[model samples]
Target: MAGGGRLLRKAFPEHWSFLLGEIALYSLVLLILTGVWLTFFFAPEMSEVVYQGRYVPLRGIRMSRAFDSTLHISFDVRGGLLVRQMHHWAALVFVAAIGVHMLRIFFTGAFRRPRELNWVIGVTLLVIAMSEGFAGYSLPDDLLSGTGLRIAQGIMLSLPVVGTYVSMFVFGAQFPGEDIVPRLYAMHILLLPGLLIALVTVHLMLVFQLKHTQWRGPGRSNRNVVGKPLFPQFMASSTGLSFMVFGVTALLGGLAQINPVWVYGPYRPDEVSTGSQPDWYVGFLEGALRLVPPWETNVAGHTLMWNVLLPAVVLPGLLFTVLYVYPFAEQRLTGEWGGEQHLCDRPRDRPVRTGLGVAGTVFYAVLLLAGGNDIMAYSFRISLNALTWIFRIALVVAPVVAFLITRWLCRALAEAEQKRLTRGQESGEVRQTVEGGYASDHRPVTRFRPGAPRRPIGPGEHTGTASQEPSAPTRRRR
Candidate 1:
C-alpha cells in the first residue's frame, strides 16, 4: 500500500475500452499457470508407442508418444483434461483480447507519436502469440494437428532456393520427422513463453512511463490526464478483472469441450478429417491458402510456387510490415512528428484512418469466412468451386467497398456533429410561430455523464444564426 513515488501512485483511464489490455494480461497469466500444469503430463516425443491406457478402443492402436501422453493426461491423470482445456481456452482468449485491444488503439489513433513504439511492440506481440499458439497446436501430434503441420511443411517447401533445405532442417527428415514434436514443444514451453513474458513486462512498464491517452472532451486534454489513481482505484478494478477472466476460463475449461485429441486419434499421414479447421487466429491464413489460385513459376531449374508462397508467406509478411509501418507513415503524412500526442483522436475526425481500419477488418473477416468455404458449401448444398470463386471475388471487392462506405459514414457523422453544434437537437413539440408558421423548438445538445458534473456549453460552441426553430427550455438532469 505504501507507494511513495512508486508505480502504485500511477493513474489509469476509467474507460471500459481501456480494460481490454488487462483482459489480455490476465488471460496470459492463466495460460502460463495452466500450461505449466499441462507440461508435467505431456510427452513431447515422436517415438511410436501402442496406446494402452484409458478407453479400450484406442488400446493397442499404434500412436506417437506425444499422442499417447496426451491420452494419458486426458484420462489417466487427475483433472489433467480440465487443465489442458483451460490452457487452450486461455491461449484463445489471450490472442483475442490482444486483437481487440489493438483495434481499440488503432480506431482511437492511440498509436500515434510517442506511443508508436508501443504500437510496434503490440504488433510484434500479436505475431509471437500466434506463433506460440501454432506451435502448441502442433505439439499434440493428433491427426488434425498433423494435417496442419503437413500444410505447414508444404508452405515451407513452397519457398525459393532454400525451401528444400529449410523444410528438411525443420522436420529433420522427409515429413512427420522424429524431432518435430520435441522441437515445437521446446519452443512452445520455453522460448515463446519466455519472450511473451519479457515483452509483456516491458509493455506494462512503457504504459506506465508514457502515461495514458484520454478522449477529447471538456477538461480533458493532451496536457493533463483524467482518471483514478492506480493504488486503490485502478488496482482494485484490475484485480477484479483478472479474477473474472480466470473464473470464466476455468468455467469454460470445465464445462465446454475443446481439442478432443482422443477422438482425432494419432497422426496418420494419409488420413484427414473432413470439416476440420484450425483455431480462429489461424483461420485467415487458411482462407488465404484456399483462395489463392494454384500458380507456379519456373526459375533457374527450380519452381516458385506462387499458389503456396503468395498467400502463405507473402501475404502475412506484407500484413505485418504494413502494421509496423502504419504509425510512422501516418505521422509523416500528417506532419504530426513536430510534437507528442497525449490525446486520442476521435475516429470520425480522421476518416482516412478509420476507413482503412474498417477496410482491413472487413478483409480479415472475409478471409476468415473463406477458410470454412467447404463446410459452408456442404451446409448450403452449393458448389465448392463456385463458393471458392465467390470468396476470392469477395476478398478483393469487400475491403474496397468497406473503405468507401466507412469514409462516407465518417464524413456524414462529422457533418451531423457540426450541425448539432449549430442548430442543436429538436424538442419534438410543434407550436405556432409568431408569423403563423408551425415550428419545433430546439435545445442545445447535452451529453450525458453519470456521476460527473455536466460540462457547461460555451456560447461560442453554438451560433444559431440561421436556425428556423425557437429556442427550447433547458432539460433538467437526473
Candidate 2:
C-alpha cells in the first residue's frame, strides 16, 4: 500500500488538451455502467411479437421480439429509458472525445518513439468502441439499425467470390436472420467491449509508464515535466470530471431524443424511412457509398461491384492500415529516428505534418457532408443531383486545396512567430529620424527561457532579465 501510494503521488502535466483523453476515459466508464443496467432489460431475440405497450403508434403492431422488448424497457421498466439513452449518448461522446484526443496527440507529435505503441492501442480502442456502439444500437432491431445492417451485409456481399459466404457467416443464414441479434448483443455487451477495455488498460498503462508529453511552455522540457501531483490534485480533478460527464450525459439523455425507434417502427426489408441516416460516427462510410458512382463488371464468373467494394471495404481498410502505420511512416519520412519525446512540438513548427493533419480533417469533413447531402438539398430547396455533384467535386478538391493552403499557412505562421521573437511588438510611437523620416519604434521582445522560475525566491526581490536591443538598427533612411 505504501509503494502504491508513492506511485499515486507521481506528477501529471497541466494542460487543457490533456483533458480530452480524460473525457474519453470517463465516457467509457459511463457507457459500461449504463450498458450493464440496460442489459438487464434488453431482449436479444428476433421472435415475432405483437407490440402491447404505451407507445400508441406501434401498439398492436407485429414486430421482432427485440423491438417489443426495447419498447418494454422504454415504457414499462422504471429508469430503463434514461439508462438506455444515457448509454447511447455516452457512446457518442466516447468516440468523439477519442477523436479530439487523437488530433491533439497527432498535431503535437505525441505519437513519436516509445509512445507509438500507445497510439496504436488508442486507435484500436476507437475502432472497437465504434463497432460496439453499432452492435448495441442494432440490438433494438429498429428500422434505422436494420437498414445499416443491410447495408453492411451488402458491402460484405460485394466482395467478389467469398462475399456470399462471409455474409452468411456473419448473419448466420440470410438477411434478418434469428441469430444476428443475439450475436450482436454478445459482441456489444461482451466481445468488443472486452477488447476495448483491454486495449484501453494497456494504453493507460503505457501513458503512465511514459509519463506525459507536454507543450513547450514555462517549466516544461524534454527532461522534466511540470504540473500537479496525481495523488490529490489530479485525482480530485479526474473524479470531478467523471461525475460531470455522468451528469451531462444524464441531462442530455433526458432532453435529447435520438434514435427514436418507436417513430421509425420495426425493420422491414421493403420499407425504409425517408432520409434514413446512421449515427454520426458511421456517416463517413455512408457518404463514401453515396459518392461512389455505380460501376460493376463481370469477371471470372463473379460480378465485381467496384463502387461498393472500393468505398466500403477497400477504402476503410486502406485508411486504417495507413493510420496504423503512420507513426513509423512519419518517423521514416522525417528521418527523426530517435529516443522518446517528452516535449511536444507546436503545430506551426512542423508545417508539413500540420498540413497533412488539416488535409485529413478536410477529407473527413467532406465525406461527412456528403453523407448528409439529401438533408442539405431539402433544407436549401436545391436539386439533389446538383448537391451530389458538388460534394463529389468538393470531396476531391477540398482536401488538396486545404493541404496546400494549410502548408502555406503553417509556414506563414512560423515566419510570424520568428518575427515576433526577433523584432518584438510595435510600440506605436513615431520618432523623427536623423534622416528626417518618421519611424515607428519596435521594441525588442524578452521571453523567459522555458523552465525558468517565474517568481522571486526571496522577499522584496524580483526575477527575469530586461529586454535587450535588437542586433540591427531599424532606422529608415529617407
Candidate number achieving the greatest lDDT relative to the actual structure: 1
**How does each model score on lDDT?**
0.87, 0.83
The residue pairs in collision within model 2 are: none
TM-score for each candidate, following the candidate numbering: 0.93, 0.93
Residue 287 lDDT, candidate 2, scale 0-100: 94
Clashing pairs in 1: none
List residue ranges in candidate 2 displaced over 4 A: 449-478
Query: Clash totals for all models, in order?
Result: 0, 0
**CA lDDT for candidate 2:** 0.83
In the range 210-237, model 2's lDDT, one tens digit per residue, is 8788666433457765566776888888
Question: What are the RMSD figures for all models against the true structure?
Answer: 5.9, 7.4
Tens-digit lDDT string for candidate 1 (155-224): 9999899999999999999897899999999999999999999999999888877888876554455666
Q: How many backbone clashes does candidate 1 have?
A: 0
